[model samples]
Target: MNTHMEAYYQKRSDIYNHVRNASTYEKIAYSFLMACFTGIAAQIVIPLSWTPVPITLQSFAVMTAGIVLGRKYGVLSMILYCLLGLVIPWYSGMTGGLSVLMGATGGYFLGFIICAYFVGSISDKFPKSRKFIGMTGTLLIANFAAIYIPGLATLYLTMSSQGVSLSLSQLLMMGLVPFIFGDILKVLASSTFSKLVMPKEE
Candidate 1:
């Protein structure tokens, strides 16, 4: 906060002083907007195989959210998204609640937080990487770790608790392999857009 603002009657610096607050507000507002957009993306779900887990746009939005918002804002946006699930019904098949966040696919939702944080951190660290390849790598690795590890673990636990049996290959085929191509695409798009919009460092 500024301690004091001198009035420059002729130059009109007083009128421009509010820009700082407006910029801050604009950032927070954009975070909420990203939250809502990601929530909407989650609504388009496609079921596959006998498993309960289905492909959704949630991951794509998560990649974009992290790349675009950076660490602090990205995490804030996703947490807002998690909370908004209470009343917005933004999860797959239009479902939402504390229950869903703790359900079989809850790992994906929870992983979004970790993914966004690390991905954004990587982007910040290498903001000007050549053609943004570093950003793409960051996003891809984050997604892989976030979704594949936690997601498969949760799915395994959920299935095991329900007395289901599957080989390791089966688990990889069913849970991890299917999403690689999609995640790569999301990473590319996220990196490109983030690079385009991000301001150059001084």
Candidate 2:
């Protein structure tokens, strides 16, 4: 049984290595596909009455891209997503253009890129991060550092510029608190999905 399991893992490892070391064209294609996946996920939005930020599957897609594609290609995927989104109505609420990127939720778009790179870097540098617990921890940290910080900052600045005076507590309530539960769920899901699809290092 042990030998069989080892063989199975070895096969998976080989497949993963093949994809990781794929040709430049193949990597570009994969990055483009991930960008498209993010666009699709952005459409799965649950809007909040108070906050401009919507709950979307974008974080899941971003984290998954990082875990699966590693640091380099993961960043590429997010860059492609952001750039293409400027012209395509693929952002949340099916809205697009520079205005959307300059809006309250714009920081999250930047966060997506940074989050992907941060998660991907950790996943690549620490092989253990491919495991469930490690991946989940990494995702959680990335969410706070790479996602929420910039997200909240941009939200505050944008709202302030529009003459909306909100306290820091209120900003947290709108931009951070409401999304905590859902973000936790997304972290778990992203970790699980990543572990299932990513092979254990031989």
Candidate 3:
């Protein structure tokens, strides 16, 4: 078991090293491709029973991009994702437009840039496979701040603009609480996929 485990990690590490040593253009191209994939992941949506926020594969893709692409490329790709969202109608619920982006949920979409950077940055801190997966999963909670702070704050402001009363507790119940289990599942799945697909570092 130990020998096979060592061989598995060795092969994963070697592939990672080769990818890392590739030309900058190649790396950027790969990251851009991953970014596009993440955008598609965003469109895989499941509306929730209680909240306006749907459960999408976005967080999974966003988080995984960071870990796989590293901070600089991860963030770059997400920014591209955001710009593309403006015209492509690929935002949540198949919505788009700069107007849609600047509206209530823009924060969440914008947050993906920060999310990829922050989560990818921290996940890169670990060296071993076990540490990488565990640390990334643990860091997912902290990374939620990247998503929620802007999302909830803007949501409240948007509600106020329409003379709707959306309290903090209500926001938590609707936006945060319900997504906890699903997000955890995403984190775990992404981390596990990382273990099989790539090395700890980009």
Candidate 4:
């Protein structure tokens, strides 16, 4: 029994390595393609009350990518997308380059990467659970951390720089309040898709 168990473990390891090696290039390519797709999606405007950065569905795409691709690939796709936005001029929108990184909307873009990893990690950890529960919880936690915090910070800084003084209540209304419903919808839609398309456990 001990020998059989050892052999089983070894075989699994070997298979994992073989699969990794075989799919490395394809994974890389897909990650990059997804990133590009993300950038293009971002360019499509969905203007919101918060700022010029409209409430785009690209965040949903990023979240879904993470749940589907797992951690490393999800993060890779996000990084690739950001790098492409920095490098490829045509990939960006009305503004381009690292400038976008500094913009008010940048936090959400950055959040997309973090959100993906968070959602992916949680889903991967808790397989065999109901899809909505896993996806919703992960997404809520991730987006709250990755989007709200940084978004507020960016808004504060931008406001301060612009000398636009506003109370916390006003700030919340302007920065966070407008997008909650849209974000929730995005989370629900993305969670559903991720749960459906994700692979079943062995």
**What lDDT score goes with residue 143 in model 1?**
86
Distance (Å) between predicted and true CA of 132, model 2? 0.8
Q: lDDT of model 4 at residue 164?
A: 86
Candidate 4 yields a Cα-based lDDT of 0.70
Please count the clashing residue pairs in each candidate, in the order shown: 0, 0, 0, 0
Against the reference, the lDDT scores of all candidates come to: 0.74, 0.91, 0.75, 0.70
RMSD of 4: 6.8
For TM-score, the strongest prediction is: 2
Report the lDDT tens digits of candidate 3 across residue range 131-195. Answer: 54574554475457888777777777876787978887988886677778888888788777776
Q: Write the per-residue lDDT of candidate 2 for residues 16-126, one digit (tens) a residue.
A: 798799999999999999999999999999999988899888999999999888899999999999999899999987989999998998899899999999998998888
Runs of candidate 4 with Cα error greater than 4 angstroms are 1-22, 89-94
**Model 3 regions more than 4 Å off:** 1-4, 49-51, 129-133, 198-202
* lDDT string, candidate 1, 54-146, tens digits: 877787788777766777888888998988897879888888888788777877878888888887677556656413676777777888997
TM-score of 3: 0.86
Worst 10 residues of 4 by lDDT: 12-21
CA-only RMSD, every prediction: 8.0, 1.3, 2.5, 6.8
TM-score of 1: 0.81
The estimated TM-scores of all candidates read 0.81, 0.95, 0.86, 0.80
Write the residue-wise lDDT of candidate 4 on 1-202 in tens digits.
9999677656654653443355879878868777876777677656764565565667777886777566788789998877777767523354568877777666766777787787667766666432677778778777778777877778777777888886898777766787789888888887777555543342
